[model samples]
Target: MAKPVADTFSPSENAAGYVSDDNPVLGFSHMHDSGTGGLPSLGNFPLFVHPGCPGDDFTRCAYSLTFRTTSRVPGSVTAAPGYFAVNLTNSVRAEMTATQHAVLYRFGFSGDEHVDVLRDLKRPDEVEKGVPYSPLVLVDLVDLMNSRSLGGILVSPETGRVMGEGRYLPSFGSGKYDAFFCADFKGAAIRKTGTFVGNDAAENPKILDGVGSGFHIPGGSAGAWLQFERPTNNSLLARVGVSFISIEQACENAEKEIADWHFERVESDARKQWREKLGVIEVDPTGVSEELQTTFWSGLYRTLLSPQNYTGENPLWNSTEPYFDSFYCIWDSFRAQHPLLTIIDPIAQTDMVRALLDIYRHEGKLPDCRMAFCKGFTQGGSNADVVIVDTFVKKLTAGIDWDTAYEAVVSDAEVEPPNWGLEGRGNLVSWHSLGYIPWDDTDLNGTGPMSRTISRGVEYAYEDFCIATLAEALGHAEDAAKYRRRGGNWRNYWNSDQRDVFQDPNDVTVQTDYTGFMQPRLVNGTFRYHNTRACSPVQEMHRCYYDTHLDTYEGSPWLYSFYVPQDMATLIQLMGGPAAFVDRLRFFHTSGIAYMGNEQGFLPVFQFHYAGRPGLSAYFVREYIPALFNASVNGIPGNDDCAMGAFSAFAMMGFFPVAGQDVYLLSTPFFPEVRIRARTEGKWSVIKVWGFDPEGKKKYIQRAKLNGRMYTKNWITHDFFLKGGTLELWVGEEEGTWGTKEADLPPSWPVEWADGGGVGLDDKF
Candidate 1:
């Protein structure tokens, strides 16, 4: 799918795709991946527009990307569901919208009698003063990171159609991909066409091809331009068709999708598509502030922006399966984004699952992260397993090949790829034999970042648990039992004597009563000492990342210690039963150790339900909703990765999903009523609140009912949404005993297995 976006030039190297404010407009490109981390991606073939050059000299127009940059007018940028518009200081206003594979842009000219050439040059001295209104647009054969290795551009003399293709590196993945675009213009007669290299322009030879000596162009700019005569209406429309296949298909896509070149119609159609997608979930915003409402709806909007539908654009292989790209790293999205999609848009989710299976069919492994037809780094476990199983458990089986899906996940659990850093799991031998990813792991079977032992161990266990769920559902009982036992490997990293302590910004040491944390262990069975709060917000915050030597990934042991979602019954007991578990979780959230920016922190907010205190879960949900998440310009706490929006949507809707499971932990919704129309049955599942508080004071559920029957458990399943029913909750200011009983806790594995020990079935909670 096309995500035509403005590539703003920012000093921040990790400003992926786009930035909202405090950056100059680079150019409007036809493709981009939003909400991803690391260097910018796929801002290829950016089209920069110039109203006119001084003295009508075509060479006077800026040709290089750095020279062509212009500041955006302050307070003039507006973005909606499907349309984005901005005013440049150069006196040209640009607005754009898109279809599946093409972008339509409407550029409005100032129509001033006099052109500002000195100002365009950023020089004080005035040279040639005035010229009649005209326009010059150029398509640069370069990407956001200047990562073009080889590219070519051609402009048609008769039609002024600009077609180009570039081979560039993916933002966070291995290998390179080729992107193609076909740009067409309307509303003006073609004055001239030419190709440019660096600052030099020529009128002859409409094509320019360059092969870079390295990943980037050897020196300067290379592109094609189409100069236009002054239009009667002083406006121009540009339609760009993009593809991962070929330029001919790109042109065909443009002509088929936007042949009429009607800007308003395209924009309207895009808005309608977005509305249909977002209209599935309806919330009563009568009592909510506009800010909170914006937060809620915008979060829903962001969730649909990624894992884009690239059904027919894939060029890797000829297949009939739907090809959805830009997984943009599922490590961040598997927790909430995909689960939310299963409820609101099962058709798209089913297509995405089929896409994953197709990728496995061709590549021999499920990618943990993928974009632009390239394999991205595996941050931890094979998390696509979580996504596939989540859909399976939710019964999104419209067109999914469940047999192939099962084989895909089993391969992730059993096989090791050649370069596990890029795809599949590494150290599977150690994971199975040692029951943990040892800190000093010797992964001779494959290679990857040897650290994140404790983090990867816990994640791999949960991933296997997800696969076990599917195996059991498919009657593979032996496989189910084996993976169910492997799910307890998280217990191997639990070091009981590790104490919690933190040194604050003021150099003051703060010690806590909490003991026991997920620590790194050597192959010899000796626990390695890792600070309990090493990568927390209060401590070495940047120490744990993709390449860190730390035992955790983007979080501290204090946070990952609460990650045994497969069997919280055992985890609660290990932390000294439900009450003690609540105390420690509260400390983790309040003691500045938990950072909501990362996806790992999302589940712990609702984990209180597993401790038999669903009211406390509601309390924490409120604490983070308007505090860390709001509608301000800098609304989200950190990198979105689409999961931030999914987290907000799930939180405001009064429930949270444990990914790859059939459960949805219930809490107090920000709205008085929420209605979700199921995609399969065409019926609505409504959650209505009685005694609702607009001020968010009454948050504890006193009691609940499903379809007029009394309901006590704090969690619901996918059946509630599929079958269409009404869930009613009566809430109060006081902590309620409604969901506090041991029997009301969310489901978890009943048996507990120690490291290298046989499983023991314990019914006690």
Candidate 2:
């Protein structure tokens, strides 16, 4: 597993750095997404560390306290989904807590004697250790009950040496796509009292040791320590709050989550939260290698971090102005994370939509990417369209208010400003507005130059179809028909002779060059094809470039073969009928052009399965799963958004809950016995494979049944899983290999208006 990105909590000197088995990079301060996207380390948490003597890596040169030696509790220590904790021999414990805006770490070290004294000192610069530590002294410490807003001191039994102490500060972050929603929390400095000391028995220090009171640590490691207890009532737990609001809001959150418990109870509850979430998907595979299983669970855990708890009765943290709290990876996540949310947790899906709608109402425009104030992710096309379209398609909005969902979808699309730059002009949208964005049109407003005009036409046409689908669902048939007809807008950009999607035939000879050949040069790797400017019909900076001898976007002629979704029958006919379509799909699948990594490729890859090619999806899954198994490290997949990467992992596990429709497509399994435990339900759903004919790679599903009944249906509806149950399958490597005598194909109903134009709830993907 790649090292967990270090924590952003102010990281004082700890050890040679800590590495949690969950994700090694995580144990450090300044790590981004202690459980999600990798963010830069900003040194948010600052604790002082007294250096050990020159020779001491551990002993002679020591930190502020005596190092306790033991394995930090795993289940006892949760990380992410907001909490963390570690058991120090079950006596001395540590934990961290987080709200949408801030984190508070609470530590508990049992007092050795009744007269333990909490010391107040800084990192001694003139150390006897290898290197001098940052010199800083405790300015104040508070006892919660009495001077709830102020600081006080401690007289605790001191058994361990003092490492040091300091406060962490927040600074503006560096993210190009940071479209923020947090209300100016960016500039609102983190107000942690300087050089603060935390001990149990300070004056009026909140005594959390009563009955049911506790503290919950964040799921990520922030670092912790404990000192001996002392007289003077120094055995109380000090609450630390970092606030975007006054220190007051932070205190409220602390008080609410931790009123009666001391350190142990709070930490225990925090760890339990993680165990509950991770227990979502239980695994039981006998043959899959250990590496594969480990990687598998690790990736699944990563998906559980976003669209988290944000709605508080106070509403400050949920506000969009100062970019309240909840954030999402819009650019990268729409393709996967959003879809995953629909399946894994529809309620969460609704809430995310709800928060977004809230933002839209407050900000006047829904964000391209959700953040506090600035757009920190990146801008692209009608992502909101994809999100809602994909959402409604699968009926994931069952629990959400449809009227509101429709309003959000339609309203967001209507208000979306026409895009600029590459995506706007690329083949993802229509060119009827400007024929085709000129490849060099970045300098202009409406028209940007495009590599292939057809792609642009098709993309815009696709979005139009999406909008019309929603409009039709709301009884706007005219709007639906208009979009449906416009969906064919890409024909204008296609050059039949070139057999690919591209700009209209222009007199200006296009320069067919490569972005990899630019200068001494900007080394081209994954994005070399992004140099669309050089493909101008008219040469400006040099020669107008083309993607190949063909007139097309970055896609090959084969890929552009059958991407028109609305008219699949025509698409199948265009490819020469069902059998021919199947053959072409096989060609694409076997060829490397079936790039699952991109947005456009998923449908086609699955189209092969839908086309009824025996074992095609099974074959695809077999190859795709192994690729992902070898691809990502732990949970991090270095994609623009990690969602697709996670999706790939989800698929490889043998079942892809197809988006837009509530069906789960069965694929060949990497593991013989697979158990997928859902997070929303306490039930365990298992898929068993048996009765297979190894010969000819039999993949034909024959006589499929659910439970004990003889059921034959290709599409497994949402209702099929109302009370989650086991789905058993009998497989074969060859066609007609299973008992085809009784096997039934998926039910194919008449295509309704809702399928494309949003006429009814009959949406299918």
Candidate 3:
């Protein structure tokens, strides 16, 4: 039976790639998502080692038929940031490392006269033989984002070298494009080169067809292979180059990246590069365990995996500007990951905005859930708007062309694209016309996917606020005023009758009821009622609601009720005030409705800060440390989609970002000291954080100091961190209640700000 694998070491396979301690070894694959929540996207171009069995043809044998590797012993498989290694049961050891666009493979054979290097080429919906590979490499074009290959090719230019180009469609996208590769062999004692097809072996066919079947036959299993004689040092090496443009570019990239066969030098250089990037933030590891250190460091490592650099890889019109892809959706990442970059790596963030602009220039809109070379689904709003505005508000928009960006943002808000599935907002008209999306009216309207109308309403509200915030920052007062009114649309969904039930307040049970909360509204301005509780079982909720999708894009209505960050003060009043807001915040955890694993409900943990309960926020954040996350392969709670790594990183670093704002809410970090070389404007500013929790019992911030002076507030502003200085916090076990006062609270949109452009049902109808 085909059982699922847990990629404890290789998180890149995302949720699907797991090589468990108990499971037999499946060869390592290149190209994978670190911790994404969807179906595994890339496991292409795998490299494995095989033993010499009776009747085993190195060039013809299937990869799975080979003997599975023995259990990995400690130090037997060494996987660092840019490197990996494993020893097979056949006494064959394989070590691999990577550059930005290339990977190097080194194989060692122990008690053998000869050994086989294996690769099983897979193409979507084709016979295994149809998947082509030269003596060089294979371009499995049909094998893409859970989709089939439209077409692809493999080419062998000469002995010891291979190149290929292919195209495939994404599983979740609406477009297709080609990818290319070039690989070269070195230090291997090659005795012969041959081809394998359905347990049959044939001599090497020296073919170089970039458009035709290079070497693959019509049906059955097939791949190219090489039998190596016993080496001088019992080892051999291979280098593979990858590009999205063309074969020539792939070859050039390979040549430019790893010219010489210095494996150790390449490995050392890769580790150095990782060190430099990860060095942006430093936490003292004096009191933490090795596991905690691993969790912290690996969490940071996952953060760097995506928004991959496709700078010279765009197959479209040529330009000097940078291009990036692999945005599963901005909804997942813009929350914490991108915001964390502003502190750790702002240049990358600035370039990311530039890349978004370039994508807008070409695709006519910024990418939403983009996968390899194609556009995917839009989850909530045009969340890229929030990402751009978040960076802009934080003064991290250094090299971005704000004027061009403004025009694009305006276009997204003002005009509805023809295909709502592909780009721009098709629901803007309805949202503006009715001031909210009506659940029953969706059938009568030509707007967005109606499955999560309430969720979309809230997301659009925040996104509009983001756009408005940017407009105001850029001095477009009229546009800002228009969007600010639109941003208040979230108010329309508040069903005043729904109230939360804390079953047993004194006990810590995982059950709370948001029976009275944000409910869907009908076209007649009446609330659409449902009988199921927010925490109801999935089947139960589905049975109760008719034709309407109850879940709100990985969250619940009660979870999203407090999502009114644009005007939290009003939301607080609506929820009955600070104490009630804190109770509702607790209700998320007690009721088990809080989606702490993903970004949708990430803000609620910090919402306690806004509710004048900084200590509770700190308490919950600290509780999440050992329960929800770890350093193991499955350490990630859910899809490390986009910026999910930032979630962990933020918690460990003792803060959380309120998206679309320039502030970071406070908490007590796990470490004694944390330091960041924050980049702002055109200079580097050092921001330092110190925690005085030596005994480790203290989890709440009792008091704080900024630049040697007493700091009253529980949060830090972007400007405060931009012009960096020391931030010291004295922590304790009990609730401090110091920041609960109104004057000490973080900035929230006042109810008066929405007076002129109110969006209640009465105002529109």
Candidate 4:
């Protein structure tokens, strides 16, 4: 829960992307959202450390973020799973760790003896022996974006305890939220206490309350400070508890969770929690490189960093149901991250599903993205439908209210909210009538950005398909048939005449062999011409964000066209049978069109499995693993959004999930053996490779045996994990015929749409 603090040298307060090596040290805050794009989220109430202002003068202390910013000692930054440490040029070293709702920091003040001697020599009268070492730490009332609207801080003069609350805007959504913090210090006596506004700090006023205008001066800083006497061991310990409820609750949360004031104990507890969460899946790692292992574990670590557990901290409504925030965006996580969690951490997944249903119970619509107790902008479809159905298909039914879950997803399909950009689906009337979101469809029911026609059309189709899966399970036959037909709406956006052409840097246009893509259609039922490669990395990469008028969201038609996950059988046929489809898919990857950075690029990496080329799927998994996803700082190609790590972990573990479905496409694992402890039966499901290759060759799967029987299917079901078994794969240097037969392919929607409605895959797997 403790966020590392740094002051950006760039123009904006949140520039340099959270914490950077170039930015100076700003102090540690108690809350943050990791691996998210857009403006920064929740770096509020940061507490800065100063090793006693020069000459023991209170005014000499740097109270503002600008004046207090100190360069970090080069190469001194160190971080681990639950711990972080860094040395500053001010001769102060800061180390921190955290509990669920509280953070414990140990600030060490090791004065530079040589610099002290030089100061004494230069001014003998002002500094008799050496500079005083009284440490002064302050808690600022500002956030990462300085978007504070109303804030107040109160410092206890005798105890040096600071309590504050502020209403600030969410990083990526509309409206504001209230956050509170309580900070207490140990290892030092309170010498004095006061409040500061900007650089002017005084000891007279111990309480400050103001609106946004009052704190908008020079540095946009206002907070309370506690000056302490020189510690007996030159170190001070500060514990901060944060909550969305109230300052009293924040203090209670801190005192209840971290009453011992033991930094090592807190750090140890944090590490233990992480180990328990990540230890369910164990890899042998015998044939894996250290870099690949680091990539796998680090990616796994990132997957758990968000959708933070704010069960009781939610102040918007009181409910006994579990509440989780920082979904960040379900559009990103529903593809992989939530699926990964459904496998390894089903308990958390169950809680998240319950939380979504609870949100729908109060908010009237399932959120597409949510954080800071506020609604975030919906990136594409109501993808939370995918998350709920994925969990239901995997059978994570402990405390899940399936009745409410079905109602929520049906609301997304049949009803339109007033503001569809933040929650639920837009253009519902057209989605129901025209089978696609037209580029210029006029929506009278609700308002939102009239963009992402192609991307949203495919995503909404898949979402409806997911709802169909749940409806069939819950015995809602009519609802099941209706949504299942709507699931085929992706076929409406298919412009058969659309041709893809590439333009070089010299402005020469060259047509390609591939034809037909999901193009934007106008309200008049005529397809509008949109470049097939417009939003791809090789073309206008920045054209498809939240506010863009582009037809796709963060992807090209080439990528979205392959996003027909619910009906890959038809998609493969439309792209020209298996041979042509394989050729086009290979060209999409080998050419510069495919980018592994965005989450949309993830599924296509393994789409070859649908074409009966499971070997090529294995080939591309190796291609992107250590290439785009690795162990370096810039390892992830794009905004992680927690999905990058999920993609890497699933790829390295020898299987990739088709989200919202029960299918897991099989491949050769990077490790010799991978065992996952199933949450259902509490038994281990093992994937063991026979011919292990440490030199990185022999990745193609030649044959496979499940529970000592011949298994030729290219995909496995969630039941394989629910009921434990051993899946043994023998590898060779080339593709083999084990899972190449047409019947061995993963289950797909029928090619022919029947009026009575095609049967869902619920009973097939």
RMSD of each candidate? 2.6, 12.5, 6.2, 4.3
lDDT of 2 by residue, 572-648 (tens): 54344557777767756664445554445555655554455435666665555556444333333233244654566
lDDT of 2: 0.40
Q: How do the residues 266-313 of candidate 1 rate in per-residue lDDT, one tens digit apiece?
A: 989999999999989998988789999999999999999889888888
List ranges where model 4 is wrong by over 4 Å: 1-20, 111-131, 211-215, 680-682, 751-765
At residue 427, candidate 4 shows an lDDT of: 98
Candidate 2 or 1, higher lDDT: 1
Candidate 3, 1-765: lDDT as tens digits: 001111232323334454445444544444554555555555444444444433444444343213222334334767787778766444557788777777777876664444333221121232222212112122222231334343333434346565555555654557776666666777644555544432445555533233223544332123345555555676677777777777787778768878887889888998898899998777777778787778778878878777777787877768778887777667789888888877777888888889988888887887677877788777777888888888888888677999978987887787766665556665665677777777665433234465666777888888888899989988999988889988887877776665443334455443344434667777777777632244333213232121236535556676678788788887887776788778877866665556566677577878888888888877887667667778776676666774656787888778889888987888888788887765544443333334556445688777778888888787888875576677787877787866778888888764323222222433321
lDDT of 3: 0.65
Better of 3 and 4 by TM-score: 4
lDDT of 4 by residue, 49-150 (tens): 878776787787888877777667768888878888887766678888888898888999874432231111223354323557788899999887778878
Off by over 4 Å in 3: 1-28, 56-60, 63-75, 114-158, 197-201, 208-222, 442-448, 499-515, 530-548, 680-691, 751-765
**What TM-score goes with each of the models?**
0.96, 0.60, 0.87, 0.95
Give the range where candidate 2 is weakest over 10 consecutive residues by summed lDDT.
178-187
Rank ordering of all candidates by lDDT, starting from the highest: 1, 4, 3, 2
Tell how far residue 518 is off in model 1, in angstroms.
Answer: 0.5
